[model samples]
Target: MHKQRLVIAGSGSTYTMGMMMSLIEEKENFPLKEVVFYDIDEQRQERNAKATEILFKERYPELESFSYTTNKEIAFKDADFVFVQIRTGGLPMREKDEQISLKHGVVGQETCGPGGMAYGLRSIKDMIELVNDIRTYAPHAWILNYTNPAAIVAVALKQEFPDDHRLLNICDMPIAIMISYAKMLNIDVWEIVPEYFGLNHFGWFTKIYDKSGNDHTERLKSRIIDEGFTPEDTEIANDVSWQKTFEQARQMLMDFPEYLPNTYLQYYLYPDQMVEKEDPERTRARQVIEGRQNRVHSLCDGIIEKGTAKDADLHVDIHGVFMVKAAASLAYNLNERFIVITENNGIISNLPEDAMVEVPALLTANGPKPFAIGEIPTFYKGLIEGQYAYEKLVTEAYFENSYQKLVQALTLNRTVISPDKAKAILEDMMEANASYWPELN
Candidate 1:
């Protein structure tokens, strides 16, 4: 077999960088011939690049490693697979994302709301560059993107470059949430059979079963209701589930009859709109960025600060073991249904076929095979349609300059921000993320 090439975008992110570092602990890494770190900023990638090289040399000497410039041809040359976890902008802009949302009174966070849409805009250009690079240098390479606003990014990519087949978009939320569930049931996440669907941070828990055909969701829900969360559960949430699930669960249980929803938005941001007059920290994003973010990013930073380049080889999957198994299942999964993003194609009864909806699907080497969604409750239809509109608008904004599209994204977000406040926050984000998102300006 030929050697495998993995190109990891967003090498600067501590989690992405840490995941690379953890690769050393992997079992000989599946015949990796080379690994490439691609980032727009040299300063950002250098730390991770040097750290990884040191780790690889010390722990996995046989594995080859190289860091690439953002140059498309040079970076993507002959890649076999691409692992992309781009933020487009760095943490500082993320702070602005949350702050802006709070001014409008919507819960503010990195990848939800007008702020998330803002983050989405800043990222599209860089993502487009990566997409274009694949077309140029590694057309056959499979691109597994774990970028925020996964739905938005995926929609933009599929719309702009309709011909690309090597694209697979994913969010770590579902996998991470499953891990949270697995611990409650005293099993590894991979051992659990689950059915779930929704857009990235905005999805649902449809079904869950264990090796013995046990529906564990009710069990998991009861445990969490009683116990709140465990060490492992909190670890995954603080580190990588984004801020969506945990924060949302408490209210979901209180506000509706639905299963306590996932954490995609629970702990994210709770304000409706952002305003300069309010205490900056009062905004959910600011509270997170100023107060909670370091708690999260520091996990990876600690590993980097403590380790030499040689230590990079030992980076372990501290909170992401679930993904390893999910990835594995694509090749040999026992036909389990997963909530994956796929074209509706009438797979979701009553939903538009051309639209991408999250629904139960079979995972195989052939790709995600979505099953029928059957009839949804009327309430769900309206909610889903609203979210669908947001995704479409964001995707449209990327493809063309339509203020109308941006409006739709905000209206559906419905985090309790007034339309006027939403527009204000949107404008602030457009200005703050100006460098990262040229099209919006």
Candidate 2:
């Protein structure tokens, strides 16, 4: 077995510990000769680096080597796989993105509506830079990107590096949803194979087959319609906000019973309801800052003080583990099927060939081979087309630095009802994100 060198781009993130634990758990299958952590923030990265040192020394003494650095060349050199999970402006700017949109009466979410557009523009530039650096330093390395506003980032990457087969864009929301589905059906998640399609955050599960080839789509749909998407037991549903998002799947089913909808569709299909539920003063970003952010930092501080993570209260992020599995599948050519974000290329006969769609694909050493979903229903087609237009325009706006395209993108969003409201939100976002976003004409 050839040991691999892995690089994690946003090593300072709260999710890094979970990812480290995941690598520890799967070390037998995906042996790592070296692990490099790279982040721009010196203070935060130092804290995380300290915690990581404690974790490896206490838990996995057999691991060959591990280190953290701000040097891109050192981090990216000779890496077999580079996992990218960056936040361009971090949480403060994310808070601004949400509040600014809410002030204009739009659904204030980190990965949907106007907030997503704002995040997308910032992410495009940063992601492009990361891609370029990775290609330069480790030309043959596979870049498994789990960056947020994934749909837009995927589109921008497709436009920038149309021939770069090594770049694979993915999200864990579908995997989280599948875990819930597995709990609902009283079966192991790995025993179920799903047929799903749409852009990131906006998608549907059309079919779910058991290991015995039993089609359970109707059964799952009936349960969701009657009792909402309440899973019997899953870590993702533990949070009150996540629980509510799961239950809202009932409303989406009621509106369109043809397929099981992604929880994020609530933002698009019921923007008014989303607005009603949001608290402008304390948006989701603030909640994360108060919750996960504080807790993770405190844990890091404790690890540094004790010089050991043996008694630390670190929790595993099942979502982060999914990315590890993806990397393993690619490195070993497991050909495991997963939902990935890739160019449509007539996969959906109804949608544009250039749009980046999330669908099931067989992961191979060569990269993801997406399964064709054919044509979708007219309702879904229309919704997907509208959202894709907004996503594509966001990429265009970033590349062209065209303020007109930026406004047009906001106006096309389901949350924004008029050009005036779009303009207001765009101006506020521009002012708030002045330091991050490119100057637009």
Candidate 3:
């Protein structure tokens, strides 16, 4: 059993401690020889480092090593796996992304519409830099990127690092959905297998079957149509915003009625409704800043004040666990099936070969081997094509620094259809993200 060296690139993120907790729980399966936390912010990372140190000492004092650093070389050096979850401009810029879009009367979400495009533009440069650093220091390290705007990020990475099979773009939303389905079916999540396809946030569950080959798609759809996506015991269901997003699946089912929709589709399928529902002053970023951000910081402060995390109630985030599990699968050659974002390459017969699509894949020590999802219906094909065009153009814009391409990308978004609105939103985003995004002319 080879003990691995794990590096968390965005160690200051609110989710880092939860990932550490997950590593603690799965120590026996995925032994860690060393764990390094890397973040650019000194103050914030130190708080996380303090809490993690306390937890590691109290929980697993004999663990080989645990440390945090701002040095990219120190963090990535000799690392076996790099967990990348970076936010380029953090919450402040995210809030700007949302508010700017809302001012223009479009849906302003972190990972959808104009807001997502803005985020994508800022993220590409950072993501590329991280990848380059990882390759330089730890060429063999597996990079499991859980970054937002995953669809766009994946597309850009594919273009940038076409030959790097070690890089895997993943999102926990599908796993979160499966957890809900498991709760509804009264079975452990591991007992079920799902067949799904689409770009990141805009995918659907075509089939779900148990180990015994019992198809549960219709049964799940029936429940979703009647009562909405009510997962009895899950972290995502606890939040009011998330609850609304989940429940909106019922309406999507009413309209599409062919497959179970991802919660994020609410942004695209009901862009007008989403805009109407949003409060410009108090966007989702504000809620997270007030809720998860504050809570995590407070918990860290408490751990630091008490000098122990023995009694501190920390959330065991399933999202973090999912990423850790994927890493473990790769390390141990478990060949577990997971939904990840990868290039189509004929995986979806109807979509362009170059487009990145999310589909179920078998994870092994090698990399993801995506399962084939044959040609989709006309309606889904059209929707995906439009979104893929926007994603491709955004990636191109970032690399080419073409303001025209950026405008074209925003214009294709479901949330901002008009060229004038797209231009206004792009210019506002450019001004707000001046420090982060590259000069586009």
Candidate 4:
């Protein structure tokens, strides 16, 4: 058995740390030849590294063992897999992305708003470095990119590394959506055969069946068509009410006919749609502001201040399951069905040949070969080219220091109002994130 050399790029992130701890406890899941944690922020990652060391010492002492490092060459060399979960601008930048987009009358969610576009600018650079690291060290390694603005990042990678199936971008929203679909159909998600496609969060359910040939969409559609229309129900978050994804899927069933839309598509489809100032339903932003922010900050502060795990507690972490599982399947050649982002390569016949597409793919020794998604909606067809232009152009600009191209990428974001506003947002964000994107010339 080939021992896997796994390197997690953003090892300092709370989520990444949680995942490392998780792997330590679930010794059976992470059978790595070596686990390497890589991050540039030594002051921050060292703490998580210490905690990881302590836990492994106390628990999974028999495992192959782990090492944390700031040197990409040392850490990533000979790696089998590298999991990336970086926030290019960190917390301050996230807030700035939201505040700036809101100022321009756009919905300002972090991962879905102008903030996402802003973050994408920085991300394309990081992706480039990760690609370079692979070139320098683990040429055979597969990168599982779980970073923000997944759609944008995937687009950049597909164009840049056209033949490098070694790079796989993934998101868990589809997994959750599949599970929800299973609940609606009274079957396990594993048992349901779902044929789905879209850009990232914005695609939809097209075909549904069981391996045994049971059609499940009919049952799902009948319940949501308001067949027994409720009069007193306006609450979107009610238990009987659907998730944001289900609501969007319900809406898409009207015109598309073949598919139901995903929530990520909301950004592209409904640029002017009014989200409530105070959403009664759960929003990741509010969750961040109210809970995640405080908790993550306190966690960081505790480590920085204490220099020990005296106050640290083991949180049941699952993120490692996502990263390692993908790599394990690839290593073992299981060809598991995964929602991965890869170059279209004729998968979606309508999109550009280089466009990054998120669809069901099977991993093999060679890499991902996506199933065909015949054609997307006209509106999505309209969307694909314009978005791809920015994704490609931005990557080019960052690589070549093309300021004009960077501006073009911002203008194409769709959320940017005009070229003038584009300049303002770009300049302001670049200034605000000088530490992150200092290459602007």
Q: How would you encode candidate 3's per-residue C-alpha lDDT over 1-92 as one tens digit per residue?
A: 89999999988999888888888878887888899999898888999999999999988776889999999899998899999999999998
- Per-candidate clashes come to 35, 0, 0, 2
Q: Which tens-of-lDDT digit does each residue in 1-441 have in candidate 1?
A: 345676777776656544654455553424467888888777767766766665666666777666656666777888876778877666667777776666666666666677678878877777887788776888777777778777778778778777765577766566666766787788976677776655566666776788788887777766776766533544344533233335446456555546545565452233432232335455444454554445434543554687654322333454333333334445344455555666667775776666767666676666777777676667666666777778788878777866666876787676633567657766777778666664652
Alpha-carbon shift of residue 309 in model 2 (angstroms) = 1.9
TM-scores for candidates 1 onward, in order? 0.84, 0.97, 0.98, 0.81
Best by lDDT: 3
Instruction: Give the better candidate number (3 or 4) by TM-score.
Output: 3
Give the C-alpha miss distance for residue 391 in model 4, angstroms. Answer: 3.1
Candidate 1 global lDDT: 0.64
Better of 1 and 4 by TM-score: 1
What 10-residue stretch in candidate 3 is worst by lDDT? 228-237
Model 2 CA deviation exceeding 4 Å by range: 231-235
Q: In angstroms, how far off is 359's CA in candidate 3?
A: 0.5
Poorest lDDT segment (10 consecutive residues) of candidate 2: 230-239
* TM-score of structure candidate 2: 0.97
Q: What are the lDDT scores of the predictions, listed in order?
A: 0.64, 0.88, 0.90, 0.67
Evaluated at residue 59, the lDDT of candidate 2 is 79
**How does model 4 score by TM-score?**
0.81
The digit string of per-residue lDDT tens for model 2 on 34-83 reads 88999988788888888998899887788789899999999998899999
- Candidate 4: count the clashes: 2
